[model samples]
Target chain A: MGGDFGPQVVVPAAVEAAREGIAIALVGDEAVVNAELAGCDAEGLDIRVVHASQVVEMDDKPADALRRKKDSSIQVACRLVKDGEAHGVVSAGNSGATVACGMFVLGRIKGVQRPALAGILPTEKNPVVLIDVGANVDSKPQHLFQFGLMADVFARDVLGLDKPSVGILSIGEEEGKGNAAVREAFDLLKKSQLRFIGNVEGRDIFTGEVDIVVCDGFVGNVALKLSEGLATSLGRILKDELKSSWLSKLGTLLSMRAFKRFRKVTDYAEYGGAPLLGLKDIVLVAHGKSNQLAMVNCIRMAATSVRNRAHEHLVEKLADHQGLNGKSEKSAA
Target chain B: MGGDFGPQVVVPAAVEAAREGIAIALVGDEAVVNAELAGCDAEGLDIRVVHASQVVEMDDKPADALRRKKDSSIQVACRLVKDGEAHGVVSAGNSGATVACGMFVLGRIKGVQRPALAGILPTEKNPVVLIDVGANVDSKPQHLFQFGLMADVFARDVLGLDKPSVGILSIGEEEGKGNAAVREAFDLLKKSQLRFIGNVEGRDIFTGEVDIVVCDGFVGNVALKLSEGLATSLGRILKDELKSSWLSKLGTLLSMRAFKRFRKVTDYAEYGGAPLLGLKDIVLVAHGKSNQLAMVNCIRMAATSVRNRAHEHLVEKLADHQGLNGKSEKSAA
Candidate 1:
């Protein structure tokens, strides 16, 4: 309801998910959702409609909305997770609101210092998971270390990476390169048991140098958005340039097979959506302007996460790591 | 010479730059440079050879190189500019070494807080100038404001944008939605005479919302590199996808014109090279794997910067803005 094309794009996607034998609970204004689903056949689909009295505006502060708007759709969906009524929650609304609701309603897992938003980006080699992509903007080195640990567990349980190599994004590939936060994080990450691949440059993110790339929310958000913008602008430019001249047009014809492959590689929609990791329950946040196909994909991703028990796995791993560190200190003393 | 493709790609570029009537100074080992340029026609080309004793390894610490290797190629090239023997210096060598040598030799202009590396990104509307792309990792709010001032002047004098709108890169576009550093910088930039566009999100950087984008070196470097990686990966994927199937091949044939247009739009070669802004003399840094055409274009960009006196114009603008701010504060008091 908050996106530029929220209810419109989301309605058909929900219907499709029901037809495909996936259980879905549509949390929104009861009247509006029912109106949109009036003509669609929701047969044999475990479709439940939850009524919410309010909506969170995109411009509203997330913390304030969580505190004040008690009956909001996002808050209601999150509450279901808190009460074990729902396995996971999916939304295409305000990102901050969703994150805030998740943190407040579900609360952080024990031993998890901070929650980080993990975004799965489509790279040339498999998919790269970027954590802290706008969750904790002002994070300490310990928070970054925790983010790396949580992401490592999620990737192993969900993405099926045996031992994900972690990389700290920096200006250069050297150890002593970035700002104060990154430099300090590098020192900590290097000493950890995780497979730290030393420091990685921005260009290395897409090259698959590491499975998990960690940074503060501010830098991660910037890097993610910039990559999207460049892909978009480049796609538009390629379309324009291909039509400019006849020779280029013929060359493009000869190279058509290669071009389709290129399109799939750059397509973000195919990747489904980004998961807000460190949340107590599974919550997938799709792009606001997502079409029916993107929404369907997000649903599939959510189902996969729920089936894999990603959150439980993450919590267990974090606890074990913490326990090991504490035991080592006692022995040393 | 330390890049993936060394003399094979760089030698031809030097020859091409010389042929384009740009005074070329090849600053590497004399034997290697001469051997590479030996086969090419040297007629009517003002090409000179400057010999340097050392080459800064890419893996070497930037500060250590600056402090220890005083007679390196990067240092010698920058020295030529300091002594007025050359109008500009172009290198495809170590970026940190280049920045270090340039700062130590050419020196910063008066009242300039820090020198930033600004990359002109090809966006949706027009080219957007992103500054502080890896000069100062840890920066104060004052440094960011100066970066905005410098980027604005560069856009006006170099890129030919009239009253270029400047934006501070942050997680959110709202005024109060950033870290302590960004918040302080936002306040400072709002008070400056530059055309401040408040705060901009990561996605907006490529949307062409503002002509100039400013951030700390850590964030800027990550943004710039991530964009590069995405572009490269996208191009590779499109080529692979187009060749995947026969039907997609036909679609590629139909869309060949569009594909070429897309390539042209994403082509960094068209943009020539990124100017190392805030240096006393014009300095253009080419990518290590830059082709001959790219090197020639870099020379063209450097010549334009020199002809327009971009650095001098920027210094003047900074002084004027500082004076204006001082007077406004005095009047208020």
Candidate 2:
């Protein structure tokens, strides 16, 4: 009942995940979800339906959604996590609302100053995590330093890295080439015990030179959206150019095998959803227009987060690192 | 002698521009410039060598470059324009050094508070201008508002757009979506008479939805470098994937023409160098690794700025718009 395709896509995806032996909870309007699930085998699987009386529109403000939509599917899904009925929550609904509900219901980790959204993007070498990718704008230096600590744990636990090299995103590779927030954050990052690689420019994100890139939510979000837009535009232009001539058409036909590999390497669907880190419970937010494959990947990601106990690792890592704010156990809210 | 290839690429490009009836000045160590000129028909062309005693290294700080390297080639080129010996200046040198030289030697135009660098990028629909790509990192709200005004004129006269719709880059497309700097800029843009299109996210930059996307230099620079890195990485991956199999290799051979066209469409050489806006005299800075084609385009862009009188138009436009800083005539230095 979330996203542009609503239950038409979500129902099929949830059914597929259920068949794969993952416990699934369909939290939405009963009648609407039932009508979509009529053709599926829901009885023999571990899928359960939990009705929610309200819905949060994609454009709904986070504050309004938290206050007005108490029985919204997003809120109900989060409540399930808080009540120990579900290990984690996955939503393709409005991200802002999801973040609000996650914060309001399950709360942040013990020492987390600000919970950040870790956007995992594909690179030539391996996937890299970009933290705070639209979660906390107008971020302070301490918040940014905290983001690096949380992401360092996330990259190791979720991404399965032995030691993730965390790099602060800035305009230049030098320590002195960033704005006020970045300059202060640089100092904090340098003092930490994590594999701090100093300042990295935007070019370093896709080169897979670092395992994690830390930035304020505003800049991180801009980089993510810009990459998406450029990749789509380039793919479209390349396809049109190939189809413009008969020779190129023949070439494209012969190279179909190679194109598949190329597409697989660049596709966002394979990366599933980004996780909201520094939270007490795992919450993954998929693209609003996610297809069945993306949804399945999201389910897999959520289950993996539960298995690894990523939040626990983040809590320990923060406690272990030098206190950037002079206190490690202080909660933001 | 500026850029990685220095006179090896710059000399040929100046010769090509000279043949096309554009007067060219090669500002560098006379011996090095003349050595490269020996490979061309410098005697028959309208090209002259202007000697500068020093060269500013790429890693030099902008302030240091301004204070120490008074006779640097970058400084000499701008001095040529300032002294009425040349109508415009083009340098494939260190961008920070170039910006400093342009500001110090040429100064800002009348009624301009802060000059910006416009990085024009190619999109599927058309080219869009990203203002202040690395000029003003800690930019004020008034600085961004002024950037929009300056970019509006730049798009109209240089980019050939008739009333380009200017959009403020933010996390969301909503009017209430950006950080503090962006939120304040939004109000100023709304009150202005220009074809302001409200807020646009990073996705809109490549979609060509807006003619000009305005942001502080830090964000703008990140977007620019991220795009460059992604394009290069994608290209490398696609090429490697194509060559991995015989079938794909044959296909690539057949689609060579289409691939060429695709490359041409996305190539930065065709777009030329980004202009340093609000300068009293026209100054263009090409990429540090600029080749002959990019240098030629930079020279052509410099000539275009002079013929279009972009600076004069900017002066009038700043005075005509609602006074963003209460006075546009204030200079930085």
Candidate 3:
């Protein structure tokens, strides 16, 4: 689909996925896609290049792009999901555009008020799933509950956790501390049937106390970006420190094995991609500046999602829960 | 004055400040402070210990502490400011308690409705100030506007910027993006006298496009903590990466000088401490786990705040602006 480097990275990644027994429908400009794939061999694989004239720029307004450029790559990819032509859509492009396209074309799941972007963050213990990372800006208590449910389902199915505990991000771990929205969400979460672990502070995000952390897009996005910036800045700092003296360089050499293990744990690329939850079809959004290895890992992740039928499982669980809740309400009445 | 590892770190830091010709007033358990200073030389230095029995734990209710524990270190320190006994109060204690203590004891500056905790984050280009980090959770548009003004004053007086550019943290750079509070804040910021740089995304916080970034406490706290966690994790990861193989170790040795430069840039200790802005007195809050060096640096930062007369400058500017605005309103009527 549409991305920063668009067809160049997309074509090769698509070919690699196709070769690995995964059907890939590349949605972009036909000429551009073909030009990218001109030198590559996609033999004995189901690979199709869908025509999309318009390309959504990273700077373009999501609503404007969706409204004005209906035939954009993101829109076309979303249309494939709507028409049941593809099992999922993948993009490394404008996050807002992807979310807008998904909502507009695929539509939200029944009983799910707002869709959230779930980002997998590497923690000391395990990868923590953070939901609502810039998908919906203004979220209600009900929306937060739905987001928690959806994230729980995703973590259980994809992350292979038996019962993933969810925590609502707040200023304090206490029962009645936070803004109006967080307080309301906390109340709703406490009353829910899900495995809710109450409130978690900002410092607890990396401690891995809860598998799933639910927050509004504004808070989640800030957390996610701040983490990224800090990681980048720290990496730069550590590299500088190792070169300070000859003795430190020797110490670094002696502790090389330990450092490698640490690198493996902190590498964001190892997580592959973030899943756009509450969509009809699976959509994995890789980092825009992702290299070849990250792209390959993303394709592999996409294949896993499709094979597991993650979206269908989420839909079924959400439907069953809603049905049971409705029946309970009626009985109580 | 107040913190997790209270008298131990605070006393030594205060002694160091006194040695450096900065007046030191230790507002905590006098016995504990004297015991910690028994082995160290306190010659020809103005170091006085004020007794305060109450201590605020990390999990304690801030408002409750302010109401009940009137003689707590944080409260007493703030009272010193109210009574004109001290120019500034520094603490590494519970942030909530500090904020509450400041509000109740020191009171807000004229024309400032709410105070904010301004955390200085080290970025690639320069250090950026994040306002309202874990202070007032539920913030209104007017509160955010006041936070921007306070941050601007801080950058000018403390950070030494002539006209610091302020940015409202949003999902996108566009004016119409973000939630209700941010949207309202954006409008107010645009109309204000400060240098408003429009909306900035979460990713832009580290890019250093603006000197001061304004947000509600929830988002700001999450951003600050996430950045801290990410930096620590990334530093560990890079140390491991450099030891992966012999070639990598060699490369690390060759690039030792560059690596040290990088670490210096990302070192939080180098920044000293963060100021709690919008209060009548100068108050600096250091990290909870700050060592003796960090504490000493915090004292140095407090001296800087006192020397710059940050509190007096802020109060004068705010009162003058309020007076001018009031006159304009009367004339318009």
- Top model number, lDDT: 2
Best by TM-score: 2
For residue A230, give model 2's deviation from the true position in Å. 0.5
lDDT of 2 by residue, B1-333 (tens): 678889899999999999999998899999999999998887788889999999998888888989998999999888888899999988888889999889988998876778999998988878899998998887777788889999998888877788899999999988888898889888888888779999999888998778999999999999999998988888888888889889899999999987786676567888879899998988899988788999998898888778898878887887787465564224321
**Per-residue error (Å), model 2, residue A211:** 0.8
DockQ in order: 0.50, 0.81, 0.38
**lDDT at B103, model 1:** 80
Error of 3 at A105 (Å): 1.2
Q: How does model 3 score by TM-score?
A: 0.89
Residues B28-147, model 1: lDDT tens digits = 778987887787777668888898888888777778889898878888888888888888887777777777787878988877768888887777778888888888877777777788
Task: Write model 1 residue lDDT over A119-170, tens digit each, in one string.
Answer: 8887778789898888887777767777888889878877889999999888
Residue-level lDDT of model 3, residues A1-333, one tens digit each, is: 555566777788788878888888888889878888886798667988899999889888889989999999989988887898887777888878888888888887776667888989888788899998888877876677778888888887788889999999887778887777778777666766679999887878887778999999888987887677666555555655775777667766765665666666656777867888887777778778765566777777767777777778778767756854344333323
Candidate 3 per-residue lDDT, tens place, B62-158, comes to 8888988888888888888789887888888887788788777887777777788898877777789999887877687777877888888888877
